[model samples]
Target: MDLGTSLINVALLAMLFVVAVAIIRMRSLFAIVMLAGAYSLLSATWFVVLDAVDVAFTEAAVGAGISTALMLGAMLLTSRTAKSERAILGVVPFLVCVLTGAVLIYATIDLPALGDAASAANSHVGAQYLERVQADTGVPNVVTAVLASYRGFDTLGETCVIFAAGVAVVLLLGFGERSLSARSDKGRSRKESK
Candidate 1:
């Protein structure tokens, strides 16, 4: 409602759109990857304007950091720096675009407005949590109270899942410089052993 917040939201949206265009139009693989990071940052800022701080944090970390790193690493391991040099005049791509756009438009239609008060998401267990929070939970920060206390087990499980995902990515990426160098050295030394 405040003028500053409104201006910030507008700026965030504009930046998001600009980054989206940059990502789409970029030719350099590295530049495109960095633009994807910029897009994630803008998206996270937009999420923050919507009061989704948790979602924003996840987007900033997982979406921007880890995802961009994975993508760039994959680019390093592969030779294809750009997509196939195919034109978009074909019926198959046209049908796909139309279907995709229609699905997205329908999704936008069903989405709750920016600040709709009566939306089910706004009035659901979130409201219930705020209503009986003091008496039921005796905690101050409801989000922390919910994640660390009420849903502690679920949070623990989710944290474990995230850790597992990180480990999996490490394994898939063959890890970092030290391990990679050691592998090369080991390969060379194995010939000496033989």
Candidate 2:
């Protein structure tokens, strides 16, 4: 990658780190939700910089869009401010996190450098997709072709999973006016019978 792109990536990552710290330090649930959305958008920007436009689009739509909306909807059923509770700093959890991060970093040491043309990813199916996507799928956009045609089943399954999660959240939150009315009716009947 060019120096400019590298700088951009570093800046974005730094901003994400700052946002994460702010999120963890904040007590307001509303602010935390907003920061989480911002985090998703920043991640989407990073994906774009890496030339993963399809992944960026999915992140923006699902992460920044649907996720934020669903969280806000759920927030409507709860207090805006987070409840103050005793903070517990568990040594085991902290140690586990550190060890996991260390292991992940060590694992990347053997991976090929980013954008290496002869890397396994580029040499394997990626090149074939880039070369044959137009003729095979007749889709000009390689990303779209690969996502919609080559990996259609996987994409469809992901979409279904996301849709199911959204539906489940809505149901769990009891968001509709009908459910609220039904709850009120039940409460009234119980009061009258009592």
Candidate 3:
């Protein structure tokens, strides 16, 4: 990658790391949720810089937008601040996280350098798709052609999964007007009895 692109990537990654640390350290539910959304936004920006606009849009919409809204609604049903807890329980998780990160970094050592033309990802199948996508699919944009034509079923499955998950989240978050009205009626009955 060019120096400018590398610098932008580094800056976005640094911002993401800072937001993650803030989320982990904060005790207020509102602050943590906001920070998590910000982290997702930064991740989306990073994806854009890496030339993955579609993934970036998905991350921004689902990760930052829908998720933040859901969490904010859920947050309203509970206390604003989390209860203070001892850090003793966190040590094991922290150690596990560090070890996992180390292993992941080691695994990447074998991967090809970024944007290497000869890398397996850029050769053979990818080249073929680029060359033949227009002829086969009659789509001007290769990315759109790949997603809509070649991987149509996979895309549809993903859409269905996302829709189901959104429905499940709404149900779990107690957005049912019937339940709210029932709880209020019970409270009114108790008040009237007194």
User: Which pairs clash inside model 1?
Assistant: none
Per residue, candidate 3 scores C-alpha lDDT tens digits across 95-179 of 9999999999999999999778789998978888898997898888888998888899999999999899879977885457877
Candidate 3 stretches with Cα past 4 Å from truth are 89-95, 166-175, 179-194
Using alpha carbons, what is the TM-score of model 2?
Answer: 0.82
Error of 2 at 24 (Å): 1.3
Candidate 3, poorest ten consecutive residues by summed lDDT: 169-178
- Model 2, C-alpha of 162: deviation from truth (Å): 3.5
Please list all clashing residue pairs in model 3, or write none if there are none. Answer: none
What are the per-model C-alpha RMSD values against the true structure? 4.6, 4.8, 4.0
**Root mean square deviation (Cα) for candidate 3:** 4.0
Question: Lowest summed lDDT over 10 consecutive residues: which window, candidate 2?
Answer: 169-178
In model 2, which residue pairs have backbone atoms overlapping below 3 Å? none
Candidate 1 stretches greater than 4 Å from native: 1-11, 170-194
TM accuracy, model 3 = 0.81
At residue 9, give the lDDT of candidate 1. Answer: 88
lDDT of 2: 0.92
